[model samples]
Target: MYYQCFFFLQIDRQFLRISTVPLLSTFFAELDRYSPRLMEIFSRKGRQAGKEITQIMDAISKDDTIHTRRACVIKSLCTYLNEDPEKLVKAYLDSDFELQSTMEQTVMGVYVILIEGALPDDDPADIAVLIEGVEVLSDLNSIAQACALLFGLIYCLNLSYPQQLKCT
Candidate 1:
């Protein structure tokens, strides 16, 4: 799934502006904009959710380089969610199912962040609904999902790339 996203991004570099940037940069950028909104929703849940939000916010806001910040946040979130970062990262890198559960959570977490940021004026409670809204997208496979996600992200952020979409 990760590689599907990677290759999809690679193929749509003009649309995604991801050709020369690390994936983490895009994640961090989106998180920077949307984590606060997530925190707002989670905080209403109770003390535990508030604490979880704090941990995620801390990881996102840490004053470090992009790569380090991503690692920290991924590590912190995985740990808080009761998964081993070492194992998950390894499995994620290896494209294996060992980290499938954790990876799914992480992907959902990211999508939530993206959705929240995308619809800033909407209620955060609608995240699940928003996700469901995209369920009818064609080609329900990893590459297709990645392509749809990238396009959704571009639409959400109103991003403009220097290059034009072109076939190789």
Candidate 2:
């Protein structure tokens, strides 16, 4: 977990320092907890990290919402780390992270977990679990709850809301 945080910190620095695009400025600023050592590691591995950061920036191009943009960033970072989003999600569910009591609440919990990439572990499984969980959450009665789930899925998949809105 410590190393994972460090890794993100370095990536955050690289994104902020080199990229001319300021789309993620606010997002990166929120990660100030990571120290300068992480920035040093990023400097040392400039070639590789540079390529990954470029990919991340490209991913953010299609997103309008911060939720969706951050999701793309996480997905790109996962690729850089040789990790899969689905596997990371499953591992998060299996860990001791706190979950809500009801199934609906639990679905919301999982939605938040996957969207945030809060877990730092590996477990392989079909991504269907995540899809199903989000679908279930989307079916709940409250409009607010349903919207939250929908936004969570959009973020998870890095979907363009404007494009989808046009399609609908």
Name the top lDDT candidate: 1
- How well does candidate 1 match the true structure in TM-score terms? 0.27
Off by over 4 Å in 1: 1-8, 11-26, 34-63, 91-168
lDDT of 2 by residue, 1-168 (tens): 111111223433454455543323443454223323433343344466556656544633554444444444444444445444323222224343554332223232223323343322221221122232332331232222223334444454455553312221
Q: What does candidate 1's lDDT look like per residue over 58-140, in tens digits?
A: 63354434433443444444444545443323212223344335443432112221222333222222111012123212222
lDDT of 2: 0.36
Deviation of model 2 at 36, angstroms: 14
Return the TM-score for each candidate structure. Answer: 0.27, 0.27
Q: Which whole-number lDDT from 0 to 100 does residue 61 have in model 2?
A: 52
Regions of model 2 farther than 4 Å from truth:
1-53, 86-136, 139-168
Candidate 1: C-alpha lDDT: 0.37
